[model samples]
Target: MSLRIDNQTCYFDTDTLHERLPANTVTVITDSDKPMSAVEVAGQRIHITEAQAGALTVAGATAGRRYLRATDGDSVI
Candidate 1:
């Protein structure tokens, strides 16, 4: 998925992003290779599908959800 944060844009693979997330939280697992890629959109932390990611990449932004940066406070841009 492509997300805009702090005036910069970053793209992440939906699968890789979710694989490191905890069961019911936006926080990622400690062993995540790229923890700085985790994001929450419309309060959704782990259920985003590949199709949705593709759609977001095409449209830039969804109807009501705005892309937030990685919870780690690091800039991927």
Candidate 2:
């Protein structure tokens, strides 16, 4: 998968299900057969998906953090 969790030791997929992200937060909308799920952030857990996993190139930012607008065609897995 191109999308992956940004971690030092552990990693996972990064998918964007929506065009806009919630305030001070991100979302993971997925549909995968694999049991893999959720992302780790600031000791908290965010959702992750297999179907949404892929390399995403940021086209622009709407809220504040980098938003995935297009795929850079780079995968972590």
Candidate 3:
């Protein structure tokens, strides 16, 4: 599945999400099953799952944060 939330420059997949970030914004997309494990390499698009997006939102992630971290969570519906 895929999603676009709040007009944030990002895309969500089943286990990963890709993003076209704005200037100066850095995102850390960690492996949901493995805590502290960052899966994205530098100079690459941000990856996040839909469930992860919700988790990030619940964990206080916003559109304008300079640094954002998200993890894969269970799907919603």
Candidate 1 Cα errors over 4 Å, as ranges: 1-39, 42-44, 61-77
Model 1, global lDDT: 0.37
- Colliding residue pairs in candidate 3: 17-47, 17-48
lDDT of 2 by residue, 1-77 (tens): 23332321223323532122321243332223333444334444444443333321121111222333333568543
C-alpha TM-score for every candidate: 0.25, 0.23, 0.26
Overall lDDT per candidate, in order of appearance: 0.37, 0.32, 0.42
Residue range 1-77, candidate 1, lDDT tens digits: 44322221333335345233222223221214433223463345543444544544444433333344465547573
Q: List the residue pairs that clash in candidate 1.
A: none
Error of 3 at 26 (Å): 7.5
Residue-level lDDT tens digits of model 3 in 1-77:
34344444434443444454432243445544543322242344444544654544544454332333453476342
Better of 1 and 3 by lDDT: 3
TM-score of 3: 0.26
The global Cα lDDT (0 to 1) of model 3 is: 0.42
lDDT of candidate 2?
Answer: 0.32
